[model samples]
Target: MPQTPHIAFIGAGNMAQAIIKGMLAAGYPPNKICASGRTQAKLDQLTADTGIHTSIDNLSLCDQADVIVLGVKPHMMGDLVKSIAPAIDPSKHLIVSVAAGILAGSIDSWLGQTTPIVRCMPNTPSLVGKGAAGLFATTGVSSAQKHTASTIMQSVGLALWVETEAHIDAVTAVSGSGPAYYFLMMEAMIAGAEELGLSNDVAQQLVLQTAVGAAQMAQESQQTPAQLRLAVTSPKGTTEQAIDTFNKGDFSQLCSQAMAAAHHRSKELANLYKA
Candidate 1:
């Protein structure tokens, strides 16, 4: 890898933009970054905003990039890889994919060779630089390439590696789809607050702050989440009543079922790429 590798993003959507912002903030030279997209307007917008090279030509961009980020949707991945496969040098370039459920083997197959492929699942929170991402790389990826991939991901937020490609599906269930679950809970809380006569604005602010504070506390505290919950739940107190209600309704089981469904769906989506 070059001292400062040239990284190109294949799609200029929200995730790609977030990564670019993080990379720039981390002192990655804008000249070494390039992005390609289908829309000329969006390409122009990205170039104007970040001062990075942007174009609609995906195949040509691959030749100038040492690390190529496949930020396009999962359904478009196969065709996109095949389209640029001829331009990519498998021995020199590293492919990092943020598209969910697509496997490294499938990407290699599409590329027509054993290219160094890193599969990443990053959540919506990446937009705010508080995201959690899970990554899995093929055997062809070198330690230095892995470091480059890690640097890009860690720029936005937490980046962890899974032992197997199958674990990427679990990450999708937990962290990838996890934000929506939190949003649902927040929505219920806000609705309940409004039902109890609080104004919409007040209820939303209260719930959002509570969510943020609780998460901060959980991160700062040395105790486990259950321990922290117990610490707050006094004997026969309001918190205890709420806990009892959740337990009686089998909330934990419900959470498990929901995550299981997400995991199943993730696996199902990957099957779309199977021949």
Candidate 2:
């Protein structure tokens, strides 16, 4: 049997901790995982909580890991990659970056080698083990390395690969920023329910449960979301009335416009970071 790859996370922030915890919950060996961060206290706490190794030396962590997961902020990625570049063996180490808006090319350049790289755009939902992530791999990435990257992301939630690196921006628009859009809708629904004479507590409870139920139904049913909507919308029904209002308001078009804005912004941020 193949030995488990040793993975090292370059940062010990919330997202890193979430992934670490998720992997632990999924029965990944704690001894195989390690994390490095700026604060000793935080790293110590993480070690205490997960029984994984922790360090303050990034280069040493990279030396010990077969897969180096960059979990730092985008602005810090360049310096972090460069600092550990000398320690990395492109033939032996696979790079997986979770820093948003940092392109794979930029990471490759920073590493100063033709390293296998997987760029992942994972959302805040990963904190709760319900994230939807989009991954893109560079040309140098092997099939096995891609599987390793996917498995790590999957430990948290849904993980899908995009055809091209540019499609990562689309993923950013849809899933990376997707959670905020849903939260906005929930806020509107809760306010609307309260306006309709429901108490604040009741309105919030009902709106949240409704959102959860709808998502669960969509996941479990084979039917497309559009088909499910049609199934629920009877002629002259209350659902039809609400659907008509949304249509009249051009809700679908508005959603498209909003997502486009997000896509454009994602590109802008990437360019800014690359510059």
Over 1-275, each residue of candidate 2 has an lDDT whose tens digit, in order, gives 02588999999999999999999999999999999999999999999999999999999889889999999999898888889989999889999999889998898889787889999999999999999999999988888898889889999999999999999999999999999999999999999999999999999999999999999999999999999999999999999999999999999999999999999999998998892
Model 1 spans with C-alpha error above 4 angstroms = none
Q: Global lDDT for candidate 1?
A: 0.93
- State model 2's lDDT: 0.93
- Give the root-mean-square deviation of each candidate in angstroms: 0.8, 1.2
Residue-by-residue lDDT tens digits, candidate 1, 203-247: 999999999999999999999999999999999999999999999
Q: What is the lDDT of every predicted structure here?
A: 0.93, 0.93
